[model samples]
Target: MAGSFFRVACQDCENEQVVFGKAASEVNCAVCGTTIARPTGGDAEFTGSVVETVEAR
Candidate 1:
């Protein structure tokens, strides 16, 4: 199984960003610098709303 990517909308600034499902580090919003995703042991925990799941090609 391969890791997936997601389009997340930031709650604070509404910045849309693509994040890795199995991110090894914390992901922050580009516009507002807010914490968007946190790295868990396996998958990342998204703090913002998930707009869509990006298909890996």
Candidate 2:
């Protein structure tokens, strides 16, 4: 199965960004550089609020 993408809103800057569900590296906010997602060996752990889930097409 393929992993999905997520639209996350940063808590500090409220910047929205798309992140991979199985991200290998840490995902940061574009505006503030806040840690939004972290790799957990499988699905990434999100620190910010998830605005939407993007399905793979």
Candidate 3:
């Protein structure tokens, strides 16, 4: 799949942030310092709530 952006909300703190779909590293929540997403071979594995997907323009 092509790389995109995702809006994820932290389940612990309800903090929202945008992350790369194909992130090469682990993504954490900025407010609560919780693990939000993990990098895989393709799309990032999300541990938080997926709010929406951002379309590339």
Query: Quick one: best lDDT, which candidate?
Result: 2
TM-score of each: 0.92, 0.92, 0.88
lDDT per residue (tens digit) for residues 1-57 in model 1: 689899999999898999998889999999989999999989999999999999663
Alpha-carbon deviation at 15 in model 3, angstroms:
0.4
Q: For model 1, which pairs clash? A: none
**Which scores better on TM-score, 2 or 3?**
2
Candidate 3 accuracy as TM-score: 0.88
Candidate 1, lDDT over the whole model: 0.93
lDDT of 3 by residue, 1-57 (tens): 567888999999999999998888999999989999998878789999989987653
lDDT of each: 0.93, 0.93, 0.90
lDDT of 3: 0.90
Q: What clash count does candidate 2 reach?
A: 0
Tens digits of per-residue lDDT for model 2 on 1-57?
689999999999999999999999999999999999999999999999999987763
Q: How high is the lDDT of residue 57 in model 3? A: 32
Residue 41, candidate 3: C-alpha displacement in angstroms = 1.5
Task: Decide which is better by TM-score, 1 or 3.
Answer: 1
